[model samples]
Target: MPAERMADFRPDAAADVTDVVCPVTFVKALAALDELEDGRILEIRLNDGEAARNVPLSLKDEGHQVLRLTDNGDGTCALLVRKVSACPVE
Candidate 1:
């Protein structure tokens, strides 16, 4: 079987870019999640590349946890990160 890759996530799923149009960075994604009112299970569907790979680590660094990682098998992956707790105020 082929190894699961993060880069594949991007092309497989089209970024909505609808409600939010900020730079599609991992940090931006986190910030968006932080600003959300509802506790979210954010499914960051991106190509299995830098953004996809770094998101989990970035979340961990910020005290958030990645709850699930789903590969769509079509060049996209879903990173389901629950808003478990707050990122400690700095």
Candidate 2:
């Protein structure tokens, strides 16, 4: 429901990393995001703890736009990220 706030923008791609841990979680999401064109949206589903907290900031650091983060009420959350820059931060 909370994710509905951005109903106007649909994701270009989606990755589910709920089975993965912290670093790998972001890695998978990043990998999927890497395949997208600039300004495309990537929807990542991850666990609610560290992955949820860190992945968004990490993506932002990488020059991505973190659009929305929504709770599925099942210990998992969905992160909506727009790829603003495909280049990685050094």
- Each prediction's total of clashing residue pairs, residues at least 3 apart in sequence or on different chains, is 14, 0
Q: Candidate 1 on 24-88: residue-level lDDT in tens?
A: 56656666576554445566666665655776777767666566676778766767665656645
**Each model's TM-score?**
0.60, 0.87
Residues 1-90, candidate 2: write the lDDT tens digits.
375568777988889999999899989988998799998999999999999999999999888899988899999999999998655447
Clashing residue pairs found in predicted model 2 = none
Candidate 2 has its poorest 10 consecutive residues by lDDT at: 1-10
Q: Report RMSD (Å) for each prediction in the order shown.
A: 7.8, 3.0
**What do the candidate models score in CA lDDT, each in turn?**
0.56, 0.89
Q: What TM-score does prediction 2 earn?
A: 0.87
In model 2, which regions exceed 4 Å deviation? 1-5, 86-90
